[model samples]
Structure formats: C-alpha cells, structure tokens
Target chain A: MTLSPEQIIKLGDLAKLAVTEQEASTLAVQVDDVLKYIGRVNELETADSIGQWKDTVVNTNVWRADEVRAINEAERNELLASFPSREDDFAKTAPVFKR
Target chain B: MRANLTIEEVQNGLRAKEFSAVELTQWYQRQIKEKNPHLNAYLTLNEEALATASLVDKKISAGAKIGPLSGIPMAIKDVIVTQGIRTTAGSKILENYIPPYDATVVDKIKKQAGIILGKVNCDEFAMGSSNENSAFGPTRNSIAPDRVPGGSSGGSAVAVAADLCTYSLGTDTGGSVRQPAAFCGVVGLKPTYGRCSRYGLIAMASSFDQPGVLAKTVKDAAIVLESIAGPDRLDSSAKDKPLKKWAAEIDQDVRGMRVALPKQFLEEGLNTEVEKSVRLAAEKLTRAGAKVELVDWPLLEMALAIYYIIMPAEVSANLARFDGIRYGMTVGAEDLWSHYQQTRGQLLGPEVKRRILTGTYVLSAGYYDAYYKKADLAKKRMRQLFAQQWQKYQAVLSPTTPTTAFKIGEKTTDPMAMYLSDVYTVVANIIGAPGISVPGGTDSQKLPIGWQLMSAPWREDQMLRLAAVLEKE
Candidate 1:
C-alpha cells in the first residue's frame, strides 16, 4: 500500500505536475501514509457491491426543449476575454506539435 | 453600531428609517478595515460597497419592495466566483483571475439587493481543513487569535463571528463551513448537495461541494439558504423541487421529534470536553421536548476513508481544467505538456499537489476498481444506511468536530491528523444530507464547540427547527 518515490514521480507526471526530487521524496512518504490509512477500506467486503454512479437524491435525467439560442455578443466577448492569450476573437495556446 | 445588527434587525432598522443602507455599509467597511488586518479574514474588499448600498437606499426611498437581504453586507468565500472581482481561491495560480460572471448564488443574492462586501480567504481550492493552506497565509481565529480557525471556510466563519459582515457565504466540501463555524462560535449550515446551485463555484470535489452559509443565528442562515437554494438551468445537478420557505419555518416546534445520538461518534479520540458539551446539548434538546435515543451507525466509521478516495478522484477531474491553456497562470515552456507541469507545479501549493497526485494514482490504470469503484459502492451503502435511520429518527446529532480548534501549526505537518478533523462532519456530505453546526458550549480553553444535527435529504426544515430549539436553550 506504500507509494515509492518513483511511483510518486509517476503520479505527478500523470497529473501534469512537476515534482522536484526533494518534493517527490517527501511526498512519497506522505502519500504512503495516506494510502496506508485509506488501505483499511480494502478490508471491507466489495464482492457483491455495485458502483453507484448517480446521487440517490437526483437520480432522474432532466430534459430541456431543443432550441437554438445565440449568446449576446457582449457575453461572448466577455468569455473570450477570459482566455490568457487570444488571437483575433479566438483563444490562443502553445503549439501542440512542432514542425 | 450596524456591525452588531442581525439580518432581521438590519431589515427592521432600514424599514424604521433609523439608518440608511449607505451608512450601514460604511460602518461594516470601517469594521473590516479595523479588524481584517490582524485576522486576515478578507482577501479582497468591494470598492463599490458604498455605491451598491446607496443604490439600495435610493430604491427604498422610491418605495420599491426589497428582499430580506436588501443592503445587508455579506462576504463570499473566494472559491465562489464574483463577476469583475479577483477571486484567487487562495491559490497563486488564480491570483489574478477575475471571473467574467457571478456564481448562481451570488447572482441571486445580488438580485435580492444584498451588498457584496468582498471575497474572503479560504484554503487553496477549498482543499485543506485549516486556512493555513491559503497561499496568502492563514486566517487567525477571531475568538482565539493563536488558534487555527477550522477551514477551508475559515475566513467566512471568522467574518461572521467577528461581526465584519452580517452573514457570509462559504462552501463545505467536507466540514469546511461547519467546522470553522464551530471554531468561531457561529452558525454554519450545509444544505443538501444540490440545494444551492454550483454554477460558478471553483470546483474541488464536484459531488461533495455545496455552497453553505455562516451566520450569527439560525434564522439568518435560513434566510440566506432560502434565497440561494433552488433549481438552476445552468447546473444540471441542481434539484428540480420548489424551494422551501425556510425562514418561515425556523420557529416551528421540535416537541415529540425523535433524534438519534450515534454511539460511534462519542468514542475514544474525541475530546472529553466536546463530548460532554454535545451530550449536554442532547439533554437540552430532550428538555425542549425532543425524544433522544442512542443509536448504532456502523457505516459512519468508513466515511473518512471513502471521502478521501472519492473527493480526490473528483478533484483530479475538475482541476484538470487549470492546465495552463484556458485561463489563470500559464508558465511558458517548449511544449504544452511542460507548460502544464511547470505552471501547476510552480503555482499550486503542496497540499493541492498532493491531492491531485493521489487522485491520479487512485484513478489510474489497474487500481481504479480497488479504490475508486470500491469507494463509490461504500458511499452508496452509507447513503442507504442514513435513509433507513431517518425513517425512525428525525435527525442525528453529534459533535461537529472531534475537538475544539487546535493551535496554529499543530496539525499542519501531519496531513493525516488534519484529515481526521472532518471525521464527524464528512458523513453528512457523503450521504448528501443537510447538516447544521450550532454552538453548544466552550471547551476548557474557552474555544467554542459545536453540536451538529443532520437530517435526511431535503429535510433542512426539520434540521433547522432542531437547531433553533438548541439556539433558544
């Protein structure tokens, strides 16, 4: 149940977070501690258990009329303005692939 | 001064023409200036507070009808986005992010003429049990300056307790609202999961997150809850039922109502003083005509383990949006992958990183069934168990926390120890039930202890009735 430093680094990579060697070392022990504590759940009987996807309170699907409604220009501009970097009327981002 | 007025008293004073909304806003603004420096409760202040209040005054002068929250100053946890105001969520990543729109609750409160005071501090992304995780530094408990205010709603609770605002809005993913309210000796109400719309709340654990209220009295909390709770087309998970008249039902009788005291919550590791106060509160409820009984809820013990699993899983998913491309801080790098790693690594705090990493691990390949799937099943079982108990008991009562507010830096190094602080409160969230934390009494340190009352889903009316009885006693 204990997480090793390598596993901690792997987790950080998967989570898209950078971990320094020092941080990975410290976090390895901390994550291991938490996993060991949470490991108690492993003892519970899950053989017949079915994973519940929806909340018990709001289990039904809600429907709305199929209609087209355009957002106001001002509102659309506000949303576009929230992007950190933007081209003319479009959000900009770093290059996904290099030529 | 206006700082000491309750929401009802404020409304009455406005109607009586004793003071104008502008004057009241100025008074609260002055109080924030005087107190917030030492407490660090408010991270941002609305510069237009006086203007907003004056508009309310003008409306009143025009003989326009106003809601209960008209002109009442309120603080919101930074996690709840405020249009045109910088909402940091106590993280450096979003330190400069100004939301383009108000959260659904914020929008509703504004429509009622509630004056926005400012955004209060909270743990980064509402992750930690103590406000110490705040990137801006920890908020001091108003009652005991050296102790930690239970968090991530610490600032909201402290604002209400210290009278910086008439009431404050907070979010309780676990015990963020209730625990801090207990620490600060105020009333914190966490309605059912979908009670308040989560349209613009900075998502942490999506399923467990709910907007809550921290107020000086049960009635004020009910008033705020009534204003904010209802269906919102923007939030698909929001309940479709009509909103209850909570303020109208606040004074209802609790006589002959059955309440349960789960024997598990009073076990070892619980501070003796907190245990005594909660038990005495139960006795007080009995005297107030409630039929109290001891009950066994075995599933309560598994709540913390399941929460850590499910909450982090959701956290990982929801937080993926902050991958440096959309908004917030974006550290430039050679590629998008490195951009995400560097921006999140350099910006997010350690606790947030820990949750994200652990969540990634649990939901990763080969381990999903053992951890995520199992936790989901356990959560469902816990809800079923709670429903069965509600068939007999009108509400379940326990200490809001295992102990009173701990000293600052006491549990910061030990993350597991800090996680245990929410043990008594998280079960309600897992079961998607309504819970309230009311001040029971003080511990030996004179730090306040809260007694919590949880009821079935959408049963906030009965839950508040029991809390009102306790408030009276």
Candidate 2:
C-alpha cells in the first residue's frame, strides 16, 4: 500500500518537519516500498506465537538510586552554554502562543 | 615507526624509548594532515592532543608505568560527544554544538590515557550504511580513493586503514562499524549490548546503537574493548559485568570450537568472491582444528525487516530532541511549532528526515499495532532463533557485507539499496550478541572482504579467539 502525499504531509506535520510536494511524492513511493517489505512480518508464524505476548521490563539496565547527585561545575556551565537561545541561565524558546 | 602498527607495538616502542609519545602523536598528525584532505576522514582535530601526549611522555620519564592506551592516538566518531571538542554528528543542525562532557567511552579511554586525535565524520545520527549521507561530505575509501568508505563509521575505518591513527571508535547501530571496517580492511568489534555505556552517544535507535572499535588488528580491537567496556552510573543500560582481559584472551586455542556458517548469508546478491572467502575461511578453520558446518538459518532473512520497522520507530523518538529548543540552531518563526519545523527541515539531511517521517507513521495511532507491534514480536522470535543456534555452535560466521565498497554516489538516491548493506550485520544488535569483523581477504577487485563472527551474549572471548584464527591468512 502506498502512502499519498496528503498522508505524508500529515506525518511531516506530526514529525515537525516540512516536506515539499516533490519530496512528499518521492517519499510516498520510498516509504511504501519499505512498508511493503516490512509487511511480510504480518505473515510470519512461530510455534509460540499464539497468545504468548506479555508486557515485560523494557530493558536490562538497572535504575540508579533515587537521589540528586549534582553534576560538577564545569559540566553544569557547559550544558547551560549549549543552550540555543537563553538569557542568564534560562533557555529561550519561540512563544507557544501568539502575542 | 612501521606503518599500520598495532597497539602492542606502540606500547613496546614507548617503553623502549624507540619513540616518544609526543613523537608518535606527531606521526599520526602528519599522516592525517597528508591524507585527510583527499579522504575527508577527519572533520575536526583536537588541538590539545599534544598536551595529552606530553603527559604520557612525562609519566614515562618519571619511570611510572602507563596504561595500555597511553600515548596511543585514536579517532572518535563525531556522533559521540567529547568535552571541549566540537561534535556535529555529521549534521548541520549540530554544526556549532560543542559538548560539555566526554562520553563514558571517551572518559574511560582518557583514563587509560588514550590520546584524542579528533572527531571523524559519519552519516547523520548514524542512520545510513554508506558515509554518503554525512552532511559534511562522504569519506572516501582509504584503499581506493574513487570508492566509498562503508559507513556511518566511514571516517573511523578510513582513519585506521590509512594509519591516520592507531585505532578509532565508531558505533554500530546496524553495520555502521563493521561495514566500514570491511570496506577499508580493518578490524571492528561491536560488543554485546550494554557492554559499553551509551552515555554521551548521540542516540539514533537507542536499543541498537553500541560504541565499537575500529582497529588495525583483532587483538587491538580487543584492547580497545577491554579499556572501554563496563558498567557506568551515567547510562543505566551499562550493566555491571566483568571486563575481560580481551587482548590476552584472544590467543586461546580454537580447537574443538564449533562454528556455523549460515547458508542464508551466502544466498543471492552476495558477491562470489566474498562467498569464496567465507567458505575458504571455514576450510582454514577446519584445518586449524575447529569444527565448521553449513547450516540453514531462514530466520536471518527476516531480521532486516524487523530492524527497519523497529529502528525507525526508535529513531523518531530519539530525534525528537532536535526540535530547535534546547540545542543546535534555531529558526526565528512565529511560534514554537513553526520554529521546530523550519529548523529541522532546514538542518537535518534528507535521510534523517525520511527515517523520522517513516518512524512517525509506524508509531501512529492506526498503524502502531500492524507495524511496530508485529515487528516487536518478530524481534522476540529472532532472539529465540539466535539463542538456539548458539547452543550448538560456539559462533556463527558470515560475510560482513554483501559486496565490497561501491563507488561514491552509487547508492545515494536509493535508500533501500543503502539499507541492504546492513542485512548481515543487524542480527547482532537485535539479539545483543557480540560481533567482530576481520579482514577475510581481498575480493577479485582487490577490495577487502570482511569475515564476520558472532558469539553468544557476552561471549566476545570465544568470538575474538576464533577471529584470531581467521586473521592468520
């Protein structure tokens, strides 16, 4: 199944991207080819496939103890320095709502 | 110093005072200066490298024993953030972003006194198979200037192959490290997932991405892994596991070790020379007293599909941070929504955008169950299949890539074609198995072919030991 340019436009919107009509048409075909290939997963069968799904822990990584172990001064300062737009220490962003 | 020298040799040279660490660093710097313009392997050079080298030299002069990586110049993939070093991850979005702290691997390597050479180029966010997707420009194959360096670790592979550095670090989300190592004729080892901490690595598909080593020899790969692989407080995924003396363990006997050659890897689209090399490698192993057999692994074919679906799903989530709010360049648009769109659209490369969009669709409301959920189940099935294979065979061997290095721009426009390059390498990441790719031999085209080996989880010991046998010829 192919995704139309309109669907791609919708996806681009959700993804916070802006694709031109040309790119959308191209992506429509490319994305369809990928989706078609991946669709084979729907046809695959396994011995334990029936009703075996269960929610499990996401991964094996152990969580650190709950505490606020602050970063060192250099690290903190550099993180603040990387801010795209900021005043003093607070990061600045485009207004969420119109003025 | 002899060219393409291994880490051991560098250690010996320094101990014997044959060459000072400062001198060795200079040699690599000279090599980078001479070759980098043509290869585009390095995107930035560390100005403080000499200071690190001087510190190593001072330690030596004081008669203090140094670490294994002391005085060794190494390159890092740009995707791993380095404190005080410019790390762009090969995207224009992060063009001016300088990281505050080094990645866990970087910090560990620094603790071992490994001299930082510079950050190398990669496909943006480690997304593509070929280095062509790098916004900085493609890294040319060191062996053949006209050919592409298989990527997103293209610069790391090129750096090691050309002797620009003793070894380099790269990531293998899906063949980023191994493909480039194969193309450029080097050694790349992707340890079991969580073996190396992912703290400070620019996330693409968080589950699949692992920092790896690109080196001139199998043992050097082991050396790097030993230095950097361990649990970290910063990244919870890094489990507390015993770090092996990998370099020393690689010399163990391979006799009676059982190896399986997946026939699926030899099926159509595999270059004949690569197949010949793999079969010959098996024969050589047999002669070395290891058991080798051809086996049908139908499940291997389905991994690429699962990877594409799940990987893009993860990609969309990991990359949402680049919405022009916290870091990177910002576009002055009317509101936050437009700012995100304009900044990402104007900065991220086409491949990055494509994957993000595809990921958005797979995780969308209507399609989530059909694509993402199904792929998750398939991934579980693949894990079981691989676990069963490892029970009988100590390791599984395959060609690192389907073909040798292709010419520059050959697969640029074709995303699917580029994705196919990871077909053989993605299985390791999916199952969290440790993998290594050694120089199998040269194809008829004189291009290098990679002979890949995967061991059971945390079994890099047996894997590297067996790889050493193949590295003989």
Candidate 3:
C-alpha cells in the first residue's frame, strides 16, 4: 500500500494539516510503514465471531429530563479570557461561514 | 518497604491518628520535588494539595466516616479532565487548557476524598507508546534514568514507583497504563472495556481508551480501581455490569485455577530475561497449586497491526474536536478553515500530526473498507482467542513487553520500533478483555520486567486473584 507524495499531501490537506514538503517526504516513509504494519490484520480468521459487533448488551442509555439552566458566568468568563480575541461576554472571532 | 507501602497501611495510619493527611501530602510532595526534576514525571503540582489534606484530616478528627480511599494523595494523567486544572494531554495546543468539569473517574475519586497531586505527563493525545512524544518532554524511567518510561502513562507509573504518590490514575489506550507500569516496576491495570467511565476524558481512540490505575502494590491498584469502576450515565459506553469485588477477592488463592501462556506471544521477539522472569512467575503459580498450560493464539500476532489502524483512525475522529473553533487553543486566521489548520499545526506535536494524517488516509472514503473494516474483522478474530481460552483456562499469561525500558532515544526516530513496545499489551484492548501487568522481576541492568495476566471479559476478579497469588510468591 504505497502512497504517492501528492496523495499523501492531499490526505494531509483534507485533514486540515499544513505539512511542509520535507515533512511530507518523511510522512511518505512513515505512512508506508504504518500501511505495511497494519497489513498483518489480514492474517486473522474471524469468520465465526459475531459478538464483537454487538456491544449493545453492555449498557443501555436512558432518557433524562431537559431543563433550561444558567451557565456558570464566572467559568465562562475565565474561558473567554483565555481566548486570544474576545469582545463583550463572548469570544470574538471571524465568521464561521463564508459564501 | 518505605517506598512501597500499600493503601491499607496509609488509611490505617490516618485512622489511628499516626499522621494527618497534611503530613502524608507533604511527604509525597517533597518526594516529587526531589525525584521529578530528573524523571520529568509531573506536568503540574497542585498548590492546594496540603490544604485539601487538612480538610480530610479535620473530617477524620470529627469522626466523619470517609470513603476507603480518603486522604490518599495521587497524580492524574494529563489526558483525563480535571476541572479548574490544566489538562494538557501532553500536547502544546492544550498546555493551558483547563477543563471546566471533572472526568467521571475524577469525580468518583474526588468523592472518595482523594487528594489531587496534579497531572502527570503523557504522549500527546495518547498517540505513542513511549513518552518521547509528550509536548512537555519525555518521562525518564524511574529505575534507569537513561531509559525511556513506557508510556503514554509513563509519568503516572514513575510517580508511583518513585513514591511520589500512593497511586495515580492513568488512561490506557492500547496499554498506555500497563506497559509503563511494567517498565517502572509498579502495578497497572487496564480494566475491562467500559468498566470505568470515559466522560470528560480528552478523547483518543474512544473504543480502546480505558481509565485505569497505577500503584506500588497490586492491592493499592485494586483499591483505586474499586473507587473508579462501575457504570456511569455520563459515559454512554460505560458498562452496566457489576463491579468486580477486587479488594474482597484479593486474598483468594489461585489454586487449581487454569492458567495458559500464549505460545504465540512468548516465542521469538521476547527478550531472554523477560522470558525467564515470566516463566519463573509461572513456576511460582504452579507451586501455589494452579495448573499452568502452554496455549497457542496465532491471531494475537495481528493485534499490534490492527491496533495501529483502529487507534489512529479513531484518533483522527476524536482529536477532530480540537479545531480551534469553540474551545481550548485557537490561532486566529482570516478564515475559519485557516484558523483550524494554523491552530492545530502550531499546537499539536509532530507525532500527533503524523497520526492524524495517517488516520485520515485510512478512513478516507475509498480506503475505509480495506483498512478500517479489515482491522475490525481482525479484532473480531482476536476476541475469539479469548472466548476459546476462557472456556478452559481462567487466564492467559505473557511478558508485558519484549524487554525492560530501552534508552530514551533508542527508538524515538523510528516510530515503528516505538509502536512495537505495546505488542503484548494491545491484544487485550483489541479483544476488550481485562489485562494487568504485574511486576515480575528485573533484568541484569536492574530495570524491571512485568508478566501480563489477561482474563475473559468482565472477569477482573479472577485476574486479580491470580495476580495476588503471584504477588505473595
């Protein structure tokens, strides 16, 4: 499972990473090792095991009542204070979406 | 055994008024001050530890009955969330990130009146086996300072072995807790998957990450495990199965219990000293009246490979939450997308970034079946080995690692070599069985080795029983 340098960079880009050409070159070798390492998973024979896919018997989730509540103003302030940009009672930042 | 006293002794001392919690906390704090400069074991030290201990002492004086773990001071792995404390997960991005709420295990331990000794170092997002990937710095092995501490729970094990604390909480994702304990000559447990809640734990490889404990003695490990185990609603994956009576069953004999040594794990790559120590432990068990057998688990060979695939794929998913949008470290940029890339690129360590990239490639649309699904199927096969063995043998045994701790930089440049450090320990996580690393003996270098004991799913009591018997011998 060899990957081209361009393919590796594409994956990194899609993953929201800023990889240098040098780092990409190193990753090509490391990723190849990872691919080769995980290939050993193909050696197992798990034809008869079904319980591995069914962990639902372990625990069941129950519903809880929803209630409007106040956020801890002090804690929220502390959180906002750590941000590099802030305004008013919220963290200030660029718009999340652009058209 | 001043450095290896059990939790029971510490509790008894506090109950008898022999020493106040404040005194005990100070003792541990001083020990950390003296030892940690060399080991790099701790990420933060709680300034309020003694004050908290004073409160516990006042409660004890007033005859207010406390939990079994009351007044015991311990460190927490940086990966677990600690409200109002910096929980970095050994990443530069989260170096100043203080979680707003305690993780479920933290809440439980705090309820038992345990004193917080602050957070210990670990691999970034629990990505690496050795502590070299920590953004803070690598944790040196307590036994041999020149060697690496098995990680990403290396700091917790070092703290326990060096007597910096009574016990520490560690998160084991693919043997982060157990392997380090093995290397540091302490006890570590990776409880049955879902035995401990994962809520508020900075997520990393969600399916395999288990919050476990490290302690100087097997009994102390059980005491901590008891406090944190049991189902919790906060973590949806937590199991509803009854918590094992670990402390209660510690004294039970392992006589007549069928134990098997998986030949597949014992042969070839294992170090000669580790093999000798494990076999000697097996002989001790046999002398204690248990039947020891050699068993074959060929599928165990695929565990490390499957783990690397499933773990990083999940790492990519779990760490995706840190994209500088809502919380933690954020680097400002002209656009939201740039904000994410710039923030993560600056904040994450090299190993973490490498894993995220590998995970994305593996989980990409076209490659998911060939990589992720096949790894899942391999995990299924590993589980079958457990099912077959548990029906005959009560537990499986092997050396925890191929050797004792290696030199700090021995394999740092080679990620594959570092990944193989967890080769023996990863199988249990993949199979979702309970596994423990019991300190067996040391190599000629005086570095400690460990013998791993694994049992069927939800059978921690039996595993602990076997471990206790080994401890006695």
Each candidate's lDDT (Cα)?
A: 0.90, 0.90, 0.84
Choose the strongest candidate by DockQ: 2
- Give the lDDT of residue B372 in candidate 2: 90
**Per-residue lDDT of candidate 1, residues B19-73 (tens digit):** 9999898888889999999999999998878888998999899999998898999
Off by over 4 Å in 3: A44-68, A82-84, A95-99
The clash count of every prediction, one per candidate, is 0, 0, 0
Judge candidate 3 against the unseen true structure and give its global Cα lDDT, from 0 to 1.
Answer: 0.84
Off by over 4 Å in 1: A50-69
Docking quality (DockQ) for each candidate: 0.55, 0.67, 0.46
lDDT per residue (tens digit) for residues A13-85 in model 2: 9999988888889988888878888888887774355556333224444555788778988778878888889
Give the clashing pairs for model 2: none
Top candidate, metric TM-score: 2
Q: Estimate each model's TM-score.
A: 0.96, 0.97, 0.95
Candidate 2 residue-wise lDDT, B1-473, digit = tens: 67888999999999999999999999999999998999999999999999999999999999998999989999999999998899999999999999877899999989878899999999888888878889899999989999998989999999999999999999999888998999999999999998999999999999898999999999999988888999888888887888788889888899999999988999988988889889998998898899999898887888899999999999999999997777787778988888888898889888998899989989999999888988888888788777778889999989999999999989888788888888899999989898889998797788999999999999899999999999995
Using lDDT as the measure, name the better of candidate 2 and candidate 3: 2
